[model samples]
Target: MTTPNSFLVISALGKDRPGIVNALSKKILDDGCNIADSRMTVLGGEFAILLLVEGQWNTLAKLENALPELEQELDLTIITKRTEERTPSSNLLPYAVDVVAMDHPGIVNHLAEFFSQRSINIEDMMTSSYAAPHTGTPMFAVHMNVGIPSDLHIAGLRDEFMDYCDGLNLDAVLEPVKG
Candidate 1:
């Protein structure tokens, strides 16, 4: 029988440069591991990458063993952890939340508090700050994928969330995430 596939999460950080992705992906491929999911971006002067890799147990182990050498060669800080495939919850419905407002501290913390108090789970989120057009005023934007419990009252939740956003002077939208 074929060996069962195992999963590994790899995160790397380094000074921003070209060819990092090429080198890393090449190493993964050469070690017989496949990248299942990845997020790569530059923040400030740093390059950051997060990858979920899949392979047979031995193959993953081989990649793990080679990581230290690769880290030195690429001048990156590498971290790895073993994981299992995620089993999504059936009682949750996916929704999207968007917010844009004047750049300020506490926006994310407040949003998290709101969701946390409601027992909602935030699956993925991204936030950015930029200058608004014409005015060059600092502005912040957030996009989040959340899993709301199916039993929650949608209309009530929407009304409450809108009111909450209004109280915070945030422009926001809440809607189901289209598949």
Candidate 2:
């Protein structure tokens, strides 16, 4: 049997623009690397990409070399680090939380602070806003998929969040994440 290859994580950040993916993928392809998984998105005005890749150990140099040109061409930062495989956690349960409120600052910061205090793991989060009809004011919304520890008290967490939300003049909802 063949030995399993190790994986590398690549993270890239730059101004939002086209061709970032094409350039990055071309480099990976040239280096004979395979992408295991990746996440790419435009956050505010910045483009961020995270990729998990696998290939022969020595090909890492080729992968590194492939980035500088793109970095200069696109004015972005690219970083790569190796990762070790670990046994998947079977005990963790995922849940979703949705927050909607009148547009205001610090919504994300406040929510993130709360999660940080509780050591809650956010698997994914997305936030957006749109102009409310006639009012012409923006209405903000946030959706987060989080991993909740089995021992954590959901009711207590909800109460704490509600208190914070009240102070912020926002509507918050927490419910069991249904698959």
Which ten residues in a row are the worst by lDDT in model 2?
84-93
Per-model TM-score, in order, reads 0.97, 0.81
Q: What local distance difference test score does each model get?
A: 0.96, 0.84
* List of clashing residue pairs for candidate 2: none
Task: Please write out the lDDT profile of model 1 over residues 61-114, one tens digit for every residue.
Answer: 999999999999999999999999888899999999999999999999999999
**Candidate 2 to truth, TM:** 0.81
Q: How far off is residue 159 in model 2, in Å? A: 4.4
Q: Name model 1 segments beyond 4 Å from true.
A: none
